[model samples]
Target: MTSDTLAPAKPAVDLEGITKRFPGVVANHDIRITVAAGTVHAIVGENGAGKSTLMKILYGMQKPDEGTIKVNGEEVSFRTPSDAIDVGIGMVHQHFMLADNFTVLENIVLGAEPKKGANLDTGAARARITELGESHGLRVDPDRLVEELGVGDRQRVEILKVLYRGARILILDEPTAVLVPQEVDELFDNLRELKADGLTVIFISHKLDEVLNIADEITVIRRGTTVTSVPRSAVTDARQLAEMMVGSELPTPETRESTVTDRVMLDVKGLTLSGGDGGRPLLSDVTFPVHAGEVVGIAGVEGNGQSELIEAIMGMRALNGGAIHLGEEDITSWATLKRREAGIGYIPEDRHRQGLLLQASLWENRVLGHQTRPPASKGIWINRKASRADTERIVKEYDVRTPSVETLALALSGGNQQKLIVGREMSGEPVFLIAAHPTRGVDVGAQAAIWDHLRNARAAGLAVLLISADLDELIGLSDTLYVILRGRLVARLDPSDVTPDRLGGYMTGAITEET
Candidate 1:
């Protein structure tokens, strides 16, 4: 026999004819994928392209209507998450599933605690955890509370949780979504370590650059089916993979010509938020100006006063001391509704929490923020017919894919929900916009579309205060950029002069502002 015949014939994972369906939607259709052992395999797709559905099926969170799954060359069926885990497969979710009050050890050993004579074997578990940490390069103090950990450390804990359960095949979903550039590098390093230790990883991400950098094999999913799978050597870069995923060249956020005007639309001076109980101030003398037809982007690690600044600007939170001006009008003491009525549009960070009513119909949600304006309301009554008509316009113009306007917002994908919110916020032609993580959890196409909308609005003299964790987005879309450190605006720079790597230095306080 030849060497090929003597070699192993089966892959680490094999899925054939995988199919799943929901009401009026075929989430996955005849999907097929093969992953090699001891390598990083990446899955890339658009927001609504059925990637999550497929992952759910594989993890046993959802049952496939039709398919054959093979792990380690043995055909298997998983009816629950435990079944998958028993087969050596473990999944780390996109949204973390951990109690803040729990210690790291408790969170990891909650379901699978070692027992010794009717007592939980805490000593044995700690020893095992310590060993695993050293072996996998995923070290964390076992006694640290989950709440006290940073984003990167929390992620390490999640990885350890899965590894603690004896998982050899790991699935990580959007693993670096909330991480800064430095954290992303560390994550990649950890992934490399996993690969070195004879482990298989299936990484799902929307970040093409990171995927290209780390993935050994790539699979593209579109709509509800597999488009293609290529080895890393076959593909050149992120742009190529993006075109394969969305069937076009990835859109750029670069603005060739400046649209900034001297007309100042948003001005803040001496913005401060006191820390109760006489601690440090949450916002310290924050000051900035967004002129008409300009996009002023803020770059920071999450929780560094970006959210507070946005809320303060929208009048959703009280400031300790400051003045907010909109077109020369001081709106310091205005209520949230008054700010909206005065032409302030807000795209909140959490769409499900602040942007849409999940149980309500799409048409109903279209009137959410614009309830007092025309096309959504007439006099004291909601114009349901007009609102539905306008919803149709938004769905078409914004490329929101859905069956009908009567569908509940909960049934729509996250990207579609975000598109609806963007449409609603852009309706009244607000003079100033606060877009916080506007493109979070969205695919490349949706991101490009939103960036286009912002650019078009900027051209029409709309000022935008853009806050995003995406350094490239901030650098490409902003005329000016601010770096926030511990609730203070520490550095200001022209967007043209900064790179993402350089901006990451400012964000992490590794590089100080040069006076």
Candidate 2:
């Protein structure tokens, strides 16, 4: 069927000339969009392209400087998120706003608790939540604690929250970012079911493939303006969408010509890390070796000791057993800073928490790792001039989009922030690199750039331990792959023979055969 035939009889949300401005930047400029009911509209853009700002305006989190919003063809203004909720509009933020200690039912009914006879009617709330989840295909346990659930399960709880509030239009920001491939497929299936039942979904994502697969229409935003809004059938493929997002052809990486070296650079011998609360080992007997000019990828569903593995390598977490050897030296007892000085560079999984200081300036963050070293600081006094120059060089080299080095790290987009972190970590010319979820929230364009950079680093005789939840990315980048299931190495494969589906099966503990 044609898009027009499939579209709702009436537009669900019509935004005209939506303009929002921050102190020094015009975030959204004269943008116009129309999302029809019972349809999935995908918004695609580069980091810092103002897609988030536009969605915030729609969700009543931010006020527009100039705009007109029509819900069901009726112009209305929303003073708060509650006002938007009253009109059947709900937003699921990228970072889940859930209380870890609270039960799922409590979290879903937090703001608007059910009451009967001057007492909290939790039983009725739980029943309603269960019904909403079952009817909408978003299965969730209302009594489970948030801290005990996986990332995908937490997202389901968020969706149930909105459904319980009787929302017809749902806004999901990067919903599938933390999910595995299978979980992503299940989410898409649920979304299709919701659309079939006459629910309007606004899906914001950087992954073009998911957008093309799920969205009826796609909108491209560039530099705080709507570049184009076209039906999905009109666009040829992801390459075209990527070009539109970045506004240029991305640089391709040079193919590796050097033969893989046989010299081992780092080795892990039965490494084990105990969980904090007297639990079992987060990483149990995980052994791997990385050679020069090689990339060894660790692929698995997240929280299966990926974070613990990286932390053990960096010496941030205590190892319960075994040792880590860098070349010929035993460095298991070394401090994190000592490991860094001994030719180890690490890109952490959570950029906001472990990599960049959001409130600090870009230049300050750039030189944070090198503050006590030469060129950045001499003893206690920092060399701001040298640091700014270095920051500028890193920004240009990494294609980081920022107005100035003096800008706060939080002001930059997610992709740019990640680029800055990667650039800083890789700038020291370390012999070994440990990258954990390096490209989690990056766009395709940036993802390509990062892969090229890592490949180049590998080609230059650096040993890389790449950990990721994206199986496709892992297969594409690594020469060898290993699977981790419940803190144990379950299988290994050569990248040439492994498929994403097979890897996904192993990652979720469905299949355990080695190829």
Candidate 3:
């Protein structure tokens, strides 16, 4: 054998002394990462720890202020995403980007459609998509509309979209953030297939367990720098990895003592809503009550009317039938603003859509829902000083990692944004809080802090309706739990008695109330 055959091959991706800086923050500094060819390389970090920034530099979304990037042992500079793509790199963002009205094939071949004369050669594109799907175990029908596909299938389409562009290396940013347990398993399977086919995957995630389970090598980044990079064998457990990422022990959501009270604070009776195509009701006869100093968690698969139930309670959606009462007063007829003023706090699931104005500063966002109230406003005149001061307080209290209160909401990391929202809602002295996926994309540290806040609020006699896809969070934080399936409250589970596996079965409709 030759000397070259005996030596190991170079990494698919190598970054040396990479540094990135913003106005008042050093996003990354002297970061080094190496991904062995055809292996799953996981990047684990807390929110605002520069994981995404490094990935952006790698994918050409942002250029590093210093250092070098090497692809397959060859130095390269990527000025744009297209430049990275040209060097066989592709990135799947945390959010799925697809035209809702377009077909799968159309979406896949959108910017790079094959041309035959003046017309688009969709047939050739479809054939290639089919071949890619079969070869990579990413099976999907090209004729299906993007809107009609499920989340897992949509993710597959995204992977196929990049594969169609001839990418040898893939960067997945929080790919399983929105997927359920089963869907996540399937996604891992798909990833394994990609790895088997000699494609390198750079995975970035806050979920340490998933990272440990799927990754060949794990890189821990903290405070805008790489802490350590180790093979899977070097790390013993997710707890160790989390501690490395956060530089401390992991926090748990488990409540010590039951703070649930007998006084019912929020009451919903016979809640019903019309479904799509006028078939089944979206929320059917959903009746539940959250007592003062209690967290009533709703556990269900995503899209099984969790959003509708929260919206109905918030008065954002009109109910066909049902009575909602806060304390003793009927609030079913109230508008969204009225509900807000009535001490019903809302932390929306999609933060960007219902929570904050990206263009506005953090202080401005703090005054959003509480605009007409005292502190944020005085008789319709904005209290800018009060808002700014209060925002600074929230930033300090909630541990929102930001340079200043004047920073734009868009500048903060997802977890920090979530923390700010949590602080804002809790600051309003709400009688009943509808916290929907409050810690969805937050890091473990932030999640623990948010849980601590919720626990503290519960101790102080706050009623909460917690909706989350994380089974552990629901089981740990909730005093009482209800399982919703196909828009109905299918099972009332005791949080102490249920396991995540059992909960998963109920969420997927595999296990019924009778069982």
Candidate 4:
């Protein structure tokens, strides 16, 4: 063989000495990583450790202050996401971007539509999308509306959307954050297929178990810098990787103590809501009582009335028939604001929609749920000084990583934003808390801290209604667990008596009460 034939090939991606800085936070500092061609490269880090910032730089959402990025051994600079797309780099964000009114094909070929004399060439787009989906293990109906798809199906559409845009490299941020166990397995299988087809994937996630299971190589980042990069085979267990990222072994969500009291804090009786679908109700005959010092968990697949149930309890949605009470006060006729004042804390599933104002500063967001009361307000007047001081307290108590209380909500990482929301909701000593996916995108370290807070709150006689997609979390922290399927309670499981797989079966309706 010739000497030239024996030379090694160039890496698919090489980021060297990359540095990024904000006003007071060093988002990234001298970061370095190299990914081999056609391999699955995983990035693991804590919430505010600068994982998102590095990915933003890679995807051209932000530019680095120093260092270089090389693709296939050739140096390149990206001024915008469009410039990054031109070089075959596509990014799938944790929060998906798609129009609910658009069909699958329309969303897939939206910005880059092929035209047939001033009209959209949808036929060609549909054919290409179908082919890409089938070949990549991501089959979906192109004619289906985006609103009709489930969470997993929606994720598949997102992956397919990037694949159809001629991307050779894909960056997925927290892709499995909302998926159930089976859906996660399916997503991993699809990723394996993509890797087999000679496409490179850069995965960013805080799930160490999933990272170890899927990644060919894993890079750990801590405090805005790369700690180490090692092959999956070289590592023995998730503990090593967890320690590398957070300087500790993975924290369990398990709660063994029983802090339940006899006092009923939140009572929902015969809760019913019309879905506007002929005769079907969105939430049907849901009756439950949460006691003081107890954690009652609701588990179900996405879009199976979990969100609607929360809305009903929080008085955001008008119930066709139901009665809600907080410690025997019939709040069935109360408004959302009235419920808030009645000591019902809410941690919404979609933080951006119901939690915080992204454009507002941290101190301003502190007044979101508790506005018009005490620290956030003073006798129907806004208390900016009190808000700022209390925001500082929450930032310190909740370990929210931020440069200043004046920082905008959009400037923090998803996990930090979640932490801030958690702190805000737990304030004012609310008697009842409705926590929906509280740790959805948070890292393991932050998740542990949040769990600790929940435990402490429960011990202090707080009643909680916890709704989550994570089976382990539900089974671990719940004193009482109820399975919801098609807007009805299917089973009430003992958290300590069930496994994640078994809990998942009930959540997905595969295991019924009859079975």
The true-versus-predicted C-alpha distance at residue 131 of model 3, in Å, is: 2.2
Candidate 4, 382-491: lDDT as tens digits: 99999999999999999999989999999998899999999999987899999999999898889999999999999999999999988889989999999988889889
Model 4, CA-based lDDT: 0.92
Model 3, range 94-208, lDDT digits (tens) per residue? 7899987999999999899999999999889989999999999999999999877867899999999999999999999999877777888899999999999999999988778
Q: In candidate 2, list every pair of residues with a backbone clash.
A: none
- Residue 201, model 3, lDDT: 97
CA shift of 266, model 3, Å: 1.6
User: lDDT score of model 1?
Assistant: 0.90
Report lDDT (Cα) of residue 161, candidate 4.
Answer: 85
Clashes of each: 0, 0, 0, 0
The per-residue C-alpha lDDT of model 4 at residue 240 equals: 83
Q: Which ten residues in a row are the worst by lDDT in model 3? A: 506-515
Whole-model lDDT, candidate 3? 0.91
156: Cα error in model 4, Å = 0.8
lDDT ranking, high to low: 4, 3, 1, 2
